[model samples]
Target: MSKTKSPIELYTKEYYAACTLGGIVACGPTHSSVTPLDLIKCRLQVDPTLYRSNTSGIIQILKKEGLGKLFTGVGATCIGYSLQGAGKYGGYELFKRLYSTHLVKDEATAYKYRTSIYLLSSATAEFFADIMLCPFEAIKVKQQTTMPPWCNNVIEGWKKMYAKEGLNGFYKGITPLWCRQIPYTMCKFTSFERIVEAIYARLPTKKSEMSALQQISVSFVGGYMAGILCAIVSHPADVMVSKINNERKVNESMNVALKRIYSRIGFVGLWNGLPVRILMIGTLTSFQWLIYDSFKAYVGLPTSG
Candidate 1:
């Protein structure tokens, strides 16, 4: 008789699916819910002179475009981020596992090298995640910056760009995206890991003794703390991506676009949307970790802090 798979094998597919689904649910709807904030953030980044604050930015958009205008590019934001989440969380797990096998050592040794592993694994995953994100992100930025909004939805935006500018138009900001996302993700995973370790190290009780809710709360704290750093680290390149997509010509080189955007506003302008970004990213990252780790545990996989 054929031997049955072990317990881990019994739910392997289901558990892995949950890993990806957790990230999708965590990031996609959360990002869509913050569409107004993101829309304002983008405007502040590209045209700070026009928008002095979030409140004023919303008022301007409403007066000029209407309430529906606030949701421009939200569809692309959701779909694109869902794809990115899958690549990020799924790829992180894949690369981390692969690297762990090579770095095989005692638990203490692993902890000693934790930060390096986290950084390298995060960078690998983000590379794949950015590939999924760039096209949709390009579409979203175009829609957000275009007068009266560029297209009705992601599909329309993609179609219009493909017809007009071809494939190159959809990925013009990929380089800046990597520049922004790589550091952001590295800080995200590493800081979250370290923060969680610090928080737990002081606890009277062990992690295994804590209830699931308590574990999730710990993850929230770490993820939020990490996210603040993530926003700060990534803001400059975030500005570059926004400015590049908004003002770049059909055949314009990224270097020329970068020089022009920076020349007009200079270095300080790159941080225009930082406060709003901190709030948005902090909460988003916290919940994403809470949901992602909770799902991993529920599906019988190893949990992280």
Candidate 2:
């Protein structure tokens, strides 16, 4: 009789698929749920004078655009981040193993240089993930930041953009999206790994010996810390992404658009939404890791470090 293979076996095709599924589950709903906060943040980034504060922004949006408007890009957020998450988490696992196995070859060497592996793996993963995210992101930002909104929904936005500028309209934000997401993901994955490792090192119980709830708690803590770092690292590019998508003139090249926007917003403008992003990303990331690891554990896989 043939022996049964473990479903949770590391680095296998099944394992990568599980990670991708977990990522989709982790990112899509969580990000969509936070669309109100994101909408406010994008508006703040684009026009700093729009609202007195985050709280006021919420009230203003409610008074002006109605409650449902807070979820302006919920569909795009769900779809785009779901696709990005699949590429990110699945690609990270693949690249991390590939790098450790091929580049270092020795287990000890791989462990010694694990941080670099984590950074490189995440950067590479996010590069492609942003490509998946960019078009939806462009739609989301345009609709959120525009005063009257660019379109009623994701489908309308997509049809209008395609009709207007063909593929280029959807893709014009790709460069800035890459700039925002790659560094953000690198900080997210690397810091989460390091924080989880540190937490395990200090704990009386070994990571493997910890209960499922305990392991997930660790994942949340690590994820929150990683998220704060991610916000700070990626805030500038994020602002630029919103600006470029919202204000780019017809026939203006990305380089020219960026330069003109920068000349106007200057250095202070780039950091406009940092605090809200820290809060948003921290909560969002913590839940993401919690959900992701919970899913992995449910499937009999070990929680990520």
Candidate 3:
């Protein structure tokens, strides 16, 4: 019988590439599958009174726009988030290693500031991820928020946006996208790492002794906890992202657009979709980490905390 070769060595280009592939698989379909929830969440964020609740939002969309409406932005969501996941997971892994090996260099000191390392790595990863994600996110938001729905689909939306506003059109919301995602990612990685570490500490079994299934389960729990914090921390900026994409005026600067949206909505409006988002993000984050770590284990790599 032939034994499988050991998993790719950590911190190698191959390792990062595998993680990026894993991220694409983890994020794309999962985010696409949640299109209906995202549709409702975006609508609710844009206009808090759009529907009484998530249930009614679905019912109303079906009643008024048909079943297909629930998946208005699935294509954009899939492609955009896949790209984002690649950058986020892969970059986090790469930067974490670089920061530890090059910056800290000392194992004890690195361990001492591990949380900071997690935060910085995640933030740096997300900075680039959001740039790749911005155009698609703009397209997705416009599709969901428009009364008639923006365009037939992502392709049409892209063509139309390009025709109307050129390349800059797609990037109008980059600033808010960064504001929303950077902090969200920072919270996500940091909290998940810390929480998983804590869970392992509390358990009698060390992490290395745990089966793959058990380790991923810990990832799920930690991810869910981290997600709740992520949603709350980032919701306000998320609201602004949707608003900027849907409501920004021609030639309006990001700052001006932000001020305008805030004036219309007020501070309370920023939290409009809080409850639904917490549910969405908590579930989403758990599954993302679950899938990510599961993929890692399948490839013979160690599961992340």
Clashing pairs in 1: none
lDDT of 1 at 224: 93
Candidate 1 residue runs with Cα over 4 Å from true position: 1-15, 104-107
Off by over 4 Å in 2: 1-6
Model 2, range 1-305, lDDT digits (tens) per residue?
11234467888889999999999999998999899999999999988889888899999989988999989899899999999999999889989999999999699999999999999999999999888999999999989988798899989999999999899999898988899999999999999999999999999998867788899999999999999999999999999999989989878998999999999999998999898999999999999999999998888788899
Least well predicted 10-residue stretch by lDDT in candidate 2:
1-10
Using lDDT as the measure, what is the rank order of every candidate, best first?
A: 2, 3, 1
| RMSD vs true structure, all candidates | 3.8, 2.7, 2.0
Best-fitting candidate, scored by lDDT: 2
If scored against the real structure, what TM-score would every candidate get? 0.92, 0.97, 0.97
Query: Which residue pairs in candidate 2 have backbone atoms (N, alpha carbon, C) closer than 3 angstroms, thus clashing?
Result: none
Residue range 1-305, candidate 3, lDDT tens digits: 11345469877888999999999888888889889999999999988889999899999999999999899999999999999999999999999998888888699999999999999999999999888898999999999998898898889999999999999999999988999999999999999999999999999988877788889999999999999999999999998999999999989998898888898889999998999899899989999999998998888888897
Q: How close to the true structure is residue 201 of candidate 1, measured as C-alpha lDDT?
A: 98
